[model samples]
Target: MSLRQTYRLWAPMYDVFLKPATRSARAKNLAQLGRLDGLNLAVIGIGSGLDLDWLRLHARPAQCIGLDITRAMLNKAQIRRRDCPFPLHLIEGDAMQTPLASGQFDYVVLHLILAVVPNPAAVLAEASRLLRPGGQILIFDKFLHPQQKAPLRRFISPLLGLLATRTDVEFEPLLAAHSELTCVRDEPLLARGWFRGITLQKHPINQHPINHHKD
Candidate 1:
């Protein structure tokens, strides 16, 4: 079965297996999103809407949007949304190419998706495209530090990918490739040193040179 299919089967048991990590990441990331009362936020790989509770604590559900590719996962998220204290926009869509308008969100959340998604660069690009200039992206996932080397793990990464996640995604290069994105914060979130909470900000549009048309 494909990775999406595997995740579809795991959807029912997803929260049970990931609750601890999810809770910790949520608290850490949410702490960085201070005073979210009026900001529009989008959770790119919203999964089963597990972060809804944390988001609601900081902002109203109306200010939040959730997106994911899998319908099964979205179905579970719908259940979660129904139980939420307020309503939120939940759309079944791909992170690399979501239906959300450009510069629509003041903040974009990318929790545990870098390794799960096939093209991390494309995903980041889309997130950047969706975010308003100067907006921040809160990313929580397992990734190798730019300077670290893991030859053995890299060799087995393909086998690991069979289970639905890549084992060795390096964050620095991805951030470096995007001139508009700057890594403002990076810290280890899980004790094993495998997972991290990173915050990146997209530079304002005017930061780049503009081409003017002759009047």
Candidate 2:
């Protein structure tokens, strides 16, 4: 089956598979978006609307767009969106291509989607293209360790990528290298830097230099 087809088969039970993230347990390691009082945002890969539960509490974005490759995912999201007090837009599209006007968003979030897509960089590049200058991209997913670029990881990661991920990418450099965006902060899982929550601000080249140094 194709990548999306795999998900479509599981779409009926997708929400049952995913749940309200445990706060002090597995959830603590994920991204913590403090507050979004007034932000124009778009979320790529809004799988099963799990993040929407958290977003409803944290942000009141003017326009919240959720895009994904699976139509069933969008269907579930649509049901969830109805309860949302703010605007919620759903689009069926690929990660590499966002059907949004360039330079139109204030904030965009990948929220762990990169780990499952076919082209991680292309997804991120599209994110940059869709954001207005000074807009930001927030990413949360598994990225390879900086010091330990093991041969084992290189081999295993791609195979895993074939099943459920796009790139077993080194996201730190990709976020750092872009002149239009700056990696302001990175929150890592306690023992491993493999999974992390990242904040990248687009354009004007500004950041206070986040310390991703291992503890």
Candidate 3:
């Protein structure tokens, strides 16, 4: 089955199975983004809207949008609207080709998306276009580190992709190639350091240099 079809079947089980299973990691990931109380935010690949509450804590519901490629996922996300304090827009769209205007959002939340999408670099590029200068994009997913070589995992990645997910994607190269965005935070979250919470920001050229200090 294609990624869309797999997610269609996975949508119902997502809130029940995946949500509880990854709750701690999810919370930890969102915490890395800090407080986003008054920003225009967009959640790329917002499956089932499980992270809506976190977005609500950082942004007004009206200022946030949940974009998903599959109709089934968006339909399930509708159930979260009742629980949201403000109105949350559920949009059916591709993360790689979002219809949102360029440089529109203050923040873009990319949770559990990079490993699932076919082209993560494209998604990041589109996100770069959607974010205003200094706007940050929060990423929470499993990615191979720069120095870590996952030979065994890479060999079995084809089997894993049968479930519409990729496990051996390395974030180092992608981020390194994107000159406009800079990594602000990269921390482990779950699975003995397999999954991580990483944040990247689109900053203006020749602006303040990124300080790699513990400040």
Better of 2 and 3 by lDDT: 3
- Listed per candidate, the RMSD to the true structure in angstroms reads 6.5, 5.1, 3.5
lDDT of 2: 0.71
If scored against the real structure, what TM-score would every candidate get? 0.88, 0.82, 0.89
Candidate 1 lDDT over 1-215, as tens digits, reads: 67678779879989888876569766876677745544678988888878876665555523778898888888888887875655578888889888889987878999988888778999999999998887888998889877778887678778777677888888888888899888888888885777888988888746532222211
The pairs that clash in candidate 2 are 180-203
Q: Tell me which residue pairs clash in candidate 3.
A: 36-58
lDDT of 3 by residue, 1-215 (tens): 77889999888788888788788888777665534554577889999987875555543423788899999999988887777776678899989899999987777889989888889899989988998887788888899876787888888877777676888889998897789898978888888889888889888824533232221
Q: lDDT per residue, candidate 2, 1-215, as tens digits?
A: 56688778768987674563323223443234434445578888987777777666555777888998889878888888877888888999988987788987777888767777766778888999988776778887777755665677678776766655644577856666567877777777433656677777776644322222221
* Models sorted by lDDT, best on top: 3, 1, 2
* Cα deviation of 48, candidate 1, in Å: 1.3
User: For candidate 3, what is the total of clashing residue pairs?
Assistant: 1
Minimal lDDT window, size 10, model 2: 206-215
